[model samples]
Target: MCRTTVANPMMNEPWQRLPALSLKQLQYFVTLAQLRHFTDTASRLAISQPALSSALRQIETVLGVSWSTVPLRRSL
Candidate 1:
């Protein structure tokens, strides 16, 4: 009996550090993107507006972006 094993692509690739993004942060980003309004997004997420803003800021830091340059589709 002969057995052939397939090598995993990921196993051959160099290990890379991933961004420190959380599920909650992604949810915040998607909700804000859909609503296009900070207040509305916060309300929909059951979180405070300031908290939402802080989460976005964290996302910006992780992704190396500025909200002023992001064109969020609504006034922050």
Candidate 2:
């Protein structure tokens, strides 16, 4: 006979475990989320598009979620 143990099913306290983010990454995410345009977001951030893209990727990795994965509703 084989024995198995069930793991705990509890929500993680993200605030306690998550790493701190740099100001640049936070700015990049906010701009990208608002514009939904990489180029424009980069321009607004005064950085190259590739750099902005890299920053967004880093932030996504930290947050464990893609910016596009979150549903956003626009108001008229």
Checking candidate 1 for backbone clashes, the offending pairs are none
TM-score of each: 0.69, 0.62
Global lDDT scores for all candidate models: 0.84, 0.77
lDDT per residue for candidate 1 within 43-68, as digits (tens), equals 99999989988999999999788877
How well does model 2 score by local distance difference test?
A: 0.77
Runs in model 1 deviating more than 4 A are 1-18, 74-76
Error of 2 at 15 (Å): 4.9
